[model samples]
Target: MTGRRGPTLLSLGLNRARDTVTAQTPVTDLDEQTARDELARLAKVLGGANAAYHTSDDPVISDADYDALKRRNSEIEAQFPGLKRKDSPSEQVGATPSEGFSKVTHAVPMLSLANAFDDTDVVEFDGRIRKYLGLDGAAALSYTAEPKIDGLSLSLRYEKGELVQAATRGDGTVGENVTANARTIHNVPQSLNGAPDVLEVRGEVYMSHPDFEALNARQAEAGQKQFANPRNAAAGSLRQLDATITRARPLEFFAYAWGALSEPLAETQMGAIERLNALGFQTNPLTIICDSPEAMVAHYRDIEQQRASLGYDIDGVVYKVNDLGLQGRLGFRSTTPRWAIAHKFPAELAWTRLDSIDIQVGRTGALSPVARLAPVTVGGVVVSNATLHNEDYIAGRDNKGDEIREGKDIRVGDWVQVYRAGDVIPKVADVDLSKRSKDAPVFEMPHSCPQCGSDAVREPGDAVRRCTGGLICPAQAVEKLKHFVSRSAFDIDGLGAKQVEQFYADGWIAEPADIFELRAKYGSGVQQLKNREGWGDKSASNLFDAIDDRRNIPLNRVIFALGIRHVGDAAANLLALHYATWDAFSAAMRTAQEGNPAWNDLLSIDGVGAVMATSLATTFNQAAEIASIDRLVAHLDIQTAARPDTAGSPVAGKTVVFTGTLEKMTRAEAKARAEALGAKVSGSVSAKTDILVAGPGAGSKAKKAVELGIETLDEDAWLELIAPL
Candidate 1:
């Protein structure tokens, strides 16, 4: 949420244009307080939209509505710059990376592009660029026009002609490490020739129309869920935790950009793209240099006419300054490059009848309402469902409880207009009151969980209602068990979702602990798994062997496999790396639950916040949960987190502490830098602390370091010491 930050690039370019604000008052007419409040609301809405689109690939709002709100935010900010929030949306690019994969911080931020909605906007964009460069009408300028592929963005890093890492565009700065999955893509090269010594190739990962259809056919044949669109399928495939799953998916890449280059590929954008093509990379054939704004728009129109025949999804055409030197001079805004703009196509709309509304509970017990609609074609795909977002959305309210759709609420048996432009999920755009049934009642969200019948509560500042059933809820339990054996967790080779569901139903396994006792309980009884309808002697043996194979697991895997809410793989790794051993982590959690300083220690681990700290404490405090964990631990040998190699790093494996206000950098940046250099960043100074970096206003921590005779360095000294890294 912009909270205090303000609006970001996602607010400007991610979606299509639509009127989201119902208030009649214009931005210029609003008072300062009203404007501030509106800005905050826009920030929250845009932030959530960004996360849903970038992190989950499930957007909750229509692209049009998102665009409208973003424009309004910009207007308000422009009229009142001093009222901008601390966490402005304008400062953010994408949501934080998901926890399923390792995090990779990009050498250069992958900024988003500003958008041009119409010919007027396009002309304005060109004028702005020319004006910024102080160019007159006589000075010739060139720009590149290419399809804006509606798929996931990827950055492939190469070192010395060898592919080193692949990452998604996560929050612009840090991304998910998808090297293994990227390697499985047919077009992603393992090695490159005539490439720079170090290069970060940026492109889109997409699925062709034919491949998407074929994959959907296979999914239907296998009784698996089909993808909503090619873009979604491509994104889901690329982000798969298992490389084998990614390998099975038909995905392709088109190189369009570069980051962190050792040497210039070419002086111009088109030339660079051609160079990429020569280096055995897929480049968009339609990309061309347009000498004028008229040429650019003409090319865009040509691409739009051929969009249906392209055999791939493209939501719009991207226009960029062709000259690399011009791009360098143009530079960037807060979260977008000033040298480029995306000219989006109009949104596709279709009318559908709302048949019914269904409630689905996620692993965390968030009750999501899905609108089941009569089969209708949206764009080219047949649509049967759309996301209702939350109860507020059904009641025609935005995240800030402001009226939307002219205060028109959604009801069953209503004729709804669905819209899908570039988003993976179709959104209910507007309701046709003329065709709505009079008897159709306004929908009411349930106060209890539909699955567990537990008390469902929506905490303050939270939009979704969550069930309080915890582990007792069957939906949560089953989902947790499935997640426990997921690719990043226990990863039992032969035990999958089907096996987990079957075992749970048969009373063979109720919890993760029961998984370890499988062979002991049913190895030679009448209840043996081999006697089951789908199991043979060999299959049953393999299942048991798979479970046994995971008896010795890494500490991080053990923590993540626990499926504690808010504790994802990345968070679990941080905890593991901090505590080193399972016993130490467990003991610390217990102490933290008892209101000891361990609670503060948990909070001090950089990314671990109070909410996450509370979740960890709550999980460890429960007797039932502790008992289950104890049983699970008894059957497994959890290894300690390995110390990183200290070959080139002086601070590797060392515990460092920072105290007081940092003048040179923010605390978060300082902590991140230390952690990146293989040093453990502790929140509090203790006997284990090897070095103390003290800034102005250093207090008790500094005194303690001095009393303990620990090595102490001022901010300047600390910076100088790690300057080599």
Candidate 2:
């Protein structure tokens, strides 16, 4: 989402469109309020767009534009499945038929196809289909590929081979009776000879580009309003109140699917499409049978290459299971069919002015640069921001310290290309040096933290420049507070990132310790949390109780909640396993501050090294931090970390180090498996190490382990050792 500090290009455009979205989209995942607000706003915008296009045949935005909004709505719904609204756009095909025509409820609901954003998604779709069908590698499977037409979804009902009713796919189940207008279209046959007794052919009603241009020419000559695009033109022409008017317009139809069939049309999807074409209906001629994922992607590319020349619009390529039997087995999931997908073309890119750059601080205190772009449409998504990566990137350097952009640099007022893909943040791809503006200044890294006024420094060999204010920085403090209740941390109920931010903003809480003290400070006074906005007696009480419940937490969680630099979940767990209690860990850290015997013991604990030990010691040395921790510790009983169950596991209670690449699995997978079986996976080899799994590329770690007389095993030997388990 575009930030609200100033008017982003998106906000400016939204204002120009006069559309009032309930709330701006949150930067990342949608919380409860953000989801509700965005959903309501999208519903209003899309519902309005739908009515305008379906009822009047005059759409305000392009087909691609509508798809983007609908796509955003779908994404938000997915992130918060529990917050899905009853009037969700995902459950609908189009707007309700206007009052001009009577409504028709179909026996079978017309559904929409799910979308695939890229090649990986297409491969995943194929793999998912195979997995669901209990199929494996080299198993024979096929799909029918065709252009996903950009037009209104209409269902043409027939009775005993006679055209009886024609309707729009309104909300899937019920639709407007457009029989009079539909009968005027040339491709729609009044009577069929070899069709099902109760056949309902469903497809799109579209107008070719030439026909649309000619229609617009005529409209201009007659002083009538011209449509925005062909889909709108065709939809408006077919949905005319007067049959004579619809008959005069050049509206075309392509029958690709059917509903409410009295009998099976064919055994396969392609055969059914052929049957539809035989019965006096137009079907896309480019439809092909694909036998593999590679073939499907190749077809998608082929169709995308020919999309513009085809005249009418096509947003992407649709893939359907060739075998109707397999399609049945695949079945449906909520709003879309499981056996089919619309692999959309990559989002279109647009050139926009690079307005300025903004700096954002993260939880780790790293200052990241962001490019503020003039709002522009890239694949229907309005992009106003892009990642600048770092100071070097803005100066036209790549990650490998090589120069890109032909030595050209991005600056304010330069025309830059922005690319947007599915749910991906738009990024500046290239700059038009020819359009670069004068007096543009180069971005410089800040010397002091913007959030806490602390000195910011770039550590040796590190690309990111970070603030050294630790938890004293407001930005770092809030982030640490949020992390203290993260999913992998304490995970207190009703205390999410949004709530943490709220608590920080309203002065109700600051540090992790402040959370436990909330009930004591505001339980009964006018400042009671229950009296706060968005809070009630039961909810606030539940929140306080939730806080109390987490008073007895695991040692690993307490260590992680401290947000000590370089101390990740794995490291915290290892420290907990080594010390077994908070008091022991604290005592060791206090002693380790002076580089005593406890310090060497700390460094010798598998992953714990000089850097992490120093950080742990520094944390306890800080008066402010120590006081905060002491207050937090006084409120609760901390449990010992859960050790891996060692029973029946051969690697149990062993210290192991994996050196070099393992042929059987990835390094991450191997380490995870080793830990699961009660083995302490270390990064470095030491005297305490029990064994070393050295692969072909083993380096210094293996040599050190051998020098220390630790047992060593090759990847094959390691696999053989665990083969029985």
| Top candidate (TM-score) | 2
lDDT of 2 by residue, 403-445 (tens): 8877677887887877754335677778877656577776687
Please give, for residues 63-177, the per-residue lDDT of candidate 1 as tens digits.
5556667777788789999998887777778889999999999999988888788999999998999999999877999999999887899999999999999999999999999
Candidate 2 deviation (Cα RMSD)? 17.5
Task: Show model 2 residue runs off by greater than 4 Å.
Answer: 1-355, 373-385, 398-400, 404-408, 413-429, 432-435, 438-440, 468-472, 525-527, 593-596, 645-648, 653-676, 680-725
Root-mean-square deviation per candidate: 17.2, 17.5
Best by lDDT: 1
Q: How much lDDT does candidate 1 score?
A: 0.82
CA shift of 560, model 1, Å = 50
Clashes of each: 17, 2
TM-score of each: 0.49, 0.51
On the 0 to 100 scale, the lDDT of residue 276 in model 1 is 91
